[model samples]
Target: MYAIHSVLAGLLAGSASMSALEVKSEVGRSGEDGIFQSKGIPSPATNDAATSANFKLLSGMADPNGASLDVLHDGRIPRSEDDPRSNFFFAGGSNGGRILVDLGKVIDVSSIATYSWHPGSRAAQKYQVYVADGSAEGFSAELKEDADPTKAGWEKLGEVDTSGEQPGQHAARLSPAKGKSLGKCRWVLFEVRKNPNAGPFNDTFFSEIDIIDAAGPELVRIERPKKVIRQFGSKHGNFRYTLDVSAAPDLEEWCAEHLIPVMDEWYPKIIEMLPVEGITAAESITFTLRNPADLPQNLRGVPAYASGNSVVFNADFMRRQQTGEAIGAGVHEVVHVVQFGGTREKSARQRGRANRPPSWVTEGVADYIRWFLYEPQSKGAEITRRNFDRANYDGSYRITANFFDWVIRNHEKDLMRKLNVATHDGYSDDLWKEWTGKTVQELNDGWKAYHKKKLGL
Candidate 1:
């Protein structure tokens, strides 16, 4: 009888030790099709064990430009393809980050799922999953990315790599293999990795993570808040506009009163000022006032910036500048919307070409429109005696704006328009000479001489 019992015990132990997992990956686009369901991937769970789990970043830093770690289990997904605030990612240049989810106690983990969205290579997901119950001797909750978790009392579930998939919304589901179980696990370690072949911004934009409990009660889904969008058009009805103030509802009234009128008048004027013959300006533009807390670290101090057809503003900065520089800032960013209307510059830059204009020239033109054309009385870009020595044409922003203004006044009356066209096609220093009959340095020297004489420096 003793020998028979030993044989049965050995069989049970072997079956448990052979547990394995199967991984299923799906990819799709965002819209009415839905991120997960339409692609046959499981929807994220709101009442999953991970919802109440304590998530700790065991390794790597969270990307300040992306959402916080809490977003992974927040049960909310990004509404659009590149919604940075709605997803979490590691800092750009890092290999990737590690996330540990502790469920407090061992439970039957039925499945684990991860979701991510992006319009580029970042849409892919790459990571290994490990599980532990904490009962194993020498178990450590803190596992480094390079360390082998299985060597420290963890079980390697499986490896997930969707890198070969096309760019879009992606989902990965890990479940027990046929006729097997993942066993009871209280801790899950995600060894995330960035795409090695992609650019510096290769960190995966993780939208949400789900951990299902086999014996848990019915799951609940999280409902996202409704977006508040105020729509309007250019004065001549030639262009459409959308103002998304959902993140900063308190400033809605101020936006309507002070901001809208400026954009309604200036957006068309900027398009008219910086026209490239074959290029058409964005017929519709979106202006979003984001909550300061949700903004990327780099954009926290910036008043506003434009991307694609959207202009995003730091809500706090806009609120503080409302009585002063708010309108001017709006006009400046609107100019960027017009400047980026042609994709040639962006494509050239992506291909590592040097044909794009220098940073100063791009910003100078924007400030030229803002300080000189829109509000000359403000004299915001005026270079007086105090800033004369520091005023180089390449200093960017106001200094360059003043230089451009001087060049236009003395050399070329249609310099801004000509330079705008050059920037769209393939800008070069020689183009400055062609436009104004002088090299950039000569133009810079002439502008500085005029400034120095005016300031008596």
Candidate 2:
């Protein structure tokens, strides 16, 4: 059995081992500040030498003989005070809070195993593990849900049973097939089902997580010369993307300094706007650079595409686009990644045939973030309220985007937050009533009046 050390010792060991390695992370605060920051643990680039056996040990890597902290019980349910990394309360109240682990420089990970205590009763806690393919866009949950590896882009190894498990300690393991290969993975996630004041908090607490790697095996190698590089924003299982200097001598450093941080800020805003359940951080996600020819004919700005759980962008856009205040066309394509659902169930639901969101609302939200969060002052009010005439609420693209902007400025603290949860077709009058205590017409009339007063028309 693998001998486990204390978390502090593991952190120290991991940090010491990393002294000679470069630690890459985006530096910025999420849109909202809180006690815990969603910072990426430092990860080194993938190479031949960084295999599982060679990587330094972490405190949490092995199983513990006892619980990490004293459990406080209300009746039989136990609650442990939060610790910096493992505590439950550290998770932000947002519905999609996640934990990601960067298998820095490690290769040939045959499998991963984790055990977490079910917080309520075993039956009430449902958990799943996700694996991102290396890109931040594409990922796969447990295998049975996605039997066809080619279709889902990943093979779900297996699963854990929470039934009758204790609330204080739990564990599970993922060991891929003998020949399967692994690389620099971002995490081995433990996701628990959450419900409102199921406040004995119906989730799981992790006591241990383990990684099983081939003692030695061949690795997947990236052989092509670097021509284009793309960076992505990921949350839950979805992605948003951006690209940086491709042929530059210092490509990685350039991305860390300029592109990555900006993508980090934009991430939470997009998640708040649109949410997906059933995905986690540990799974494989892809963010790649593709030719402009890859995009659908209907889109614009050197077109970027997100599918196959990966994002591909027009390299020419990054090579030649003029510098402006906002994230350019590159970031626009990244948003599409988040729109794809993990399974047929989610895809069918998102197709929204019965409750389809208006073209205006869908595209408008995308456009709003392009300017508001990524490029705050690029064109100013040129894209603001003036174009939101009463007749244009149903108008598409920029026109509707302007209208949505108007509603937020005139009513909700920031329409982005309210519009985040807005449904597709049901947006008619009830949405306005629910948001502003006014019907759609009342809201539009009020907005037009507000704009007119501003112009002194």
Candidate 3:
């Protein structure tokens, strides 16, 4: 588990006040880093880029690592958002909890031209630099005394000097080599070395650290302020909460037992699929578990919307509709949350008809993760696409999901990510051409042939 190190509140004195800043990068607008996590690279609600970066501040122990760091040993975390992005990290005494930085859902490593780390209350404690390209859990860390930025490739860029150390503060600079080549990378990790002479470890404090050349984009406020609620996170990577419900004393325990870890399972991969310039996953989301009545007009919040770093949901619907299925539905809504937003709805018929997503794509993709991560066998039951007769890709959730399942199973596994990135326009057989080198008809034919051979269908 990642530990939380507390610095004298000075480090965060101005943190909450620092609004989201975009960092223009060599990777183009789609590749910049530091936007909010809940909001997509470009928000899906208004279908535009509203915020510049996805910046997330997490307590060390509160990190996704504590719950599933083991995923790293398998050479990949469940999703990219699970990757850490804090350029600065700290530890108290020897065994004190740690204070670490994670990028959440931002992109572009080289864009961070310069950075400084000031460890509060110590001249120095041994530390190391870690790196990963989203292929493994934690980081392949490099321990040393200093880091050098001008190097030719990925190596320790700088080191901190902590000889004859005293309590107060210490700082260091990471080499350009360390931050530059990250253009092709995914996550950066750091850890504090243990001190043998220290007493019972308490907490470690951190001072303010800064990044240069990280601002990009302009803010477009689509609507006014409304009531907000959050999904309080748990130690097991389960972010749980009840919105607007009269809290049942047993709700917490019930949620602990039932709330699915669908997002926790998918976030890391989403981060990997995102452009480097975009925000890390955590920075891209604003988890709220509140009621719609708590909101101003009960606008239904656009089904599920993300205009900037914030993702709003109508919790009232979830609670009232509570069932074993709500978990999967919530996961589906959350996919929309992280994907920015779904297509626009101009009318009830349009909402239910033309404006609707193809059933296989819409539901299958969601169920892919929901079932694979939470209920694998049940997911198998949902993968049967009965509508292969396909006129205009009948816009139904279950059927579309089934087709999507077939697409993923028979063709490219990365297809879901490609579809997600391009949903800003629309998803159709044309998308199949762009991604799988086949038309929807061709894909359907191939899928049918493959399945018939396998199941003797």
By TM-score, who's the top model here? 1
Clashing pairs in 1: none
Better of 2 and 3 by lDDT: 2
Instruction: List TM-scores for all candidates, in order.
Output: 0.57, 0.39, 0.35
**Runs in model 2 lying further than 4 Å from the true structure:** 1-257, 276-285, 294-305, 325-328, 341-352, 380-391, 414-418, 424-429
User: Candidates 1 and 2: which is better by lDDT?
Assistant: 1
Better of 2 and 3 by TM-score: 2
lDDT on C-alpha atoms for all candidate structures: 0.77, 0.41, 0.37
Worst 10 residues of 2 by lDDT: 5-14
Ranking by TM-score: 1, 2, 3
Report the C-alpha lDDT of model 1 over 1-457, residue by residue, as the tens digit: 0000000011112124334434333333333333455424556777888988999999999988888889899877776677788899998778887899999988887777788888887887889787888877778889866787877878777667767666676777776544334568899999998965467678898999998888888887543445788998678558888999987788888898889888988887887888876677888889998865456656767888899888999888887888899878989988988888534423332322368788898999999999999999989999988888888889999999999899888888887788787776778888877887889999888888887787787
Tens-digit lDDT string for candidate 3 (1-457): 1111211111111111122222221101111121211121121112111122222322234333132222111211111111122222333322423222344443444322111112222223444433233433332223233432112122232233332334333223332422232232333434444433245431222222222222323323223224332354434343333332232222333444554344445554444543222323343345444444334343545333334334444455545545646566556555555555323434332122333345456455565555554456555434234533442233345555555666777677877676654444445557778777888888766656665565544
lDDT of candidate 2 over 77-122, digit per residue (tens): 1222222123232122423223334454334455454433333432
